[model samples]
Target: MEVEIISEESIKPSSPTPHHLRTYNLSLLDYLVGYPYVPIVFYYPNHNDNDNNIFQALQRSLVLKKSLSETLTQFYPLAGTLKGDSIECNDVGANYVLVLVHGRLDGFLHKPDLGLINRFLPLEPSFDQSSVGSRVTNVKVNIFKCGGIAVGLCVSHKILDGAALYTFLKGWANMASKSEEVTYPKIISPLVFPAESLRLRDIFQVSYQTVLKEAALKVAASRNGVQQPTRVEVVSALLWKCTIAASKEAYGIQKTTWLNHSLNLRKKLPTKTSKDLIGNMMRVSSAVCKDNDETTLHSLVNKVHDSIVKVNDEFVNEAQGDEWYVAMHKLLQQMGEIGSVGPTEYYIFTSWCKMGFNDIDFGWGKPSWVSGLIGKGFKGFFNLVTLMDTKCGEGVEAWVTLDEEELKILQCNPELLAYASVDPSPLSNDHVI
Candidate 1:
């Protein structure tokens, strides 16, 4: 598990960005969310023989850096430094770290040490004013003792979301092989989601983790034929249910609780945005569940679904209006009053299922695993759980970051455990390409 820093390199864009494309403005969604860095790791098994392993690793490293530089030409903003509310896309460059790992990749994969996995990451994300500075992205390539490699990338969430990152990863990999097939990501915020309207900030917390197994979710879905909860709905409801179960000790069934989740506004837009459209295009939708309410898993799912559905065409259109900002300004004053993370509050669930993250391939093979860490060292305290695609099949993995006690309560929850298991192996299938 010892990850030693062998060297570090700064990979500048292969082409100097045109002056006209230098300044990339922060979209409304970006300004509102203002999230930190999102850390993603990709593992590649070394295929070279022993003596040639070192030489091959160096060669692969060169390919990665060169391809990354070329990729930056299209994703120019990533290589630039961040200034106030915008990226100076002047081709500053991104951090690329080369590390030597003392352990084999299989050990960590077999008994997956989440902490050890993080050890491969390059930069530690921070929250200070200079944290999300220029050099919006970072790369770490860990060469395992067995010659396998793990490529860890940390991207500024303020710049893009998981979908954008996936497309970026593909472009970088394609360039590594010097392939010409590429799709330039479009910055359509100005046209679709204007920047002036994005004046909200990232507010909210608690620590917790829980998962909803695909089978159990299907069962839950079938029970209520009228309510077919997607994987995200099923998992969100399950997390709310368990949080309620765990909260019984502190607060009885008398208080009101909220389930705060994000809705992707891309599909909700009147004219569908191109899949290549990048930036944070999400809206937070809150569903209330008081103790007097049904409070059942089905009930929770119904509530969440309804709240999100309400954020439809009208709500999306309002995002471009001045009144929306006024409402947000008022909501900002009442943020603390709305709720705080105490024994009673809300859980924020962000789903990344079907984001195409599992499809990133750099010629070695598809990643053995993938995770989205907001680059925070320790887990936070809004019962935050991130659900992602298993990629092996239709199942999804709900990654919750809770303290030991609360997590144990969720882990031991008979109902949840029956459906969603924790940390299923990424290699447990015949589809690992």
Candidate 2:
């Protein structure tokens, strides 16, 4: 698990950003994101024959840097620094580091240590100004002893969410592979959502990891006389239920809990093509379980489903207008009122399940595995769950962050264990690339 720094340099855009696009303003949605940085790693196994592997790895590394330079021209804002409320697209360049890992990639993935994943990235995913600073994007290319490579990317959450992040990755991969189907970023998110000044609160804690198999997803989605719940809904409901139960057990009494599921606002927008727009275009579908509420899995599923359904096209239209300001004010007001009503827990659930992270191939082949942060090696985050698609693309891997005591009780929950495997190896699936 020892990683050595092989090289470090900044990758500037091959072409200068147009003067008109120099200052990219932050959208209101971007300002609401709790974390300042988003980090992920893509593990690509060696595919070349033994003799050719070393040469191919070196050549591919050059291609990656070259293509990334070209890609940054289109994603110009990413190469800039975030200052105050806007990105100063002065072509300061992205932080790119090359590292050499001592062990084989396979051995590391066999029993992947969530705590050590941060080593792959240039910076930790936290809100600390000193650690994150003004850097808008950071990339680390990790070369393993077995010739496999792991590309770790850390982008400012102020600029992109899961959808936008995948868009950028796919575009970069397309350029690296010399594909004709080049993906271009549409940086119109700020024009659509506009920017506003606001302050947000922060929370801190540790994490736990679990993977919910597709079989469990099917069972959780089962219900009579109702439309099937999505894997996201079912998993979120189950985790919310289990965490609430854990909290009640750890403490002495039931406490009101709130679950917030983040929804991508691309498809709901007036322009369906906004799906390709790069920025934090998202909203939250919130549901609450009162102290005396029914905490059944089925009941929780319905609640989650209903809350999600409410954020449909019609709501999106209103959210795009004046209702947006009114809603923001109401949310701020509600946050203040909650403190006076005794103890309550809040959990934020975000899905990267169908974002196509596994398909980001850069000439060699698709990645064998992709990973998000498991909330280790940093602080200022808690009661958060990030659900990602498994390598096989059938199951959901939930990276949960909670307080120590609550997470301890949740680890031994029989119902949760029946439906999910805790921190399983990435190579457990036969279909991995």
Per-model C-alpha lDDT, please? 0.70, 0.82
lDDT of 1 by residue, 1-433 (tens): 6668888878998899999988888877787664467677777766454867756776788888888988898888889887878888878799999988887776677656666666676765545523435578889989887777888887887877767777788788777765667767877765666777355666433222233456557567546632566777777777778767766644454446777777677776655446777788777887877656666777777887887777776766777878678767765555455445332465677777887777777766677777655323553333666777775746776667554555666677777777766655666642221
> 203, model 1: CA deviation in Å?
3.8
Best by TM-score: 2
lDDT of 1 at 309: 77
- TM-score of model 1 vs. true structure: 0.89
lDDT of 2 by residue, 1-433 (tens): 7888878999999999989989999887887787877788999878554866545666778899999999999999999988877888989888999887888787788888888887887777777742324879899999887788899999998899999999999999999999999797899888887765554534423367788865555565565413678888888888999998999999978888888888998988877578789999888887888888988888888889888998888756555577877876776577557635877888888999889998999988899888888675477778889999997887888888888888889999998887888888888864222
TM-score between model 2 and native: 0.94
Q: What is candidate 2's CA lDDT for residue 343?
A: 79
- Give each model a TM-score: 0.89, 0.94
Lowest summed lDDT over 10 consecutive residues: which window, candidate 1? Answer: 203-212
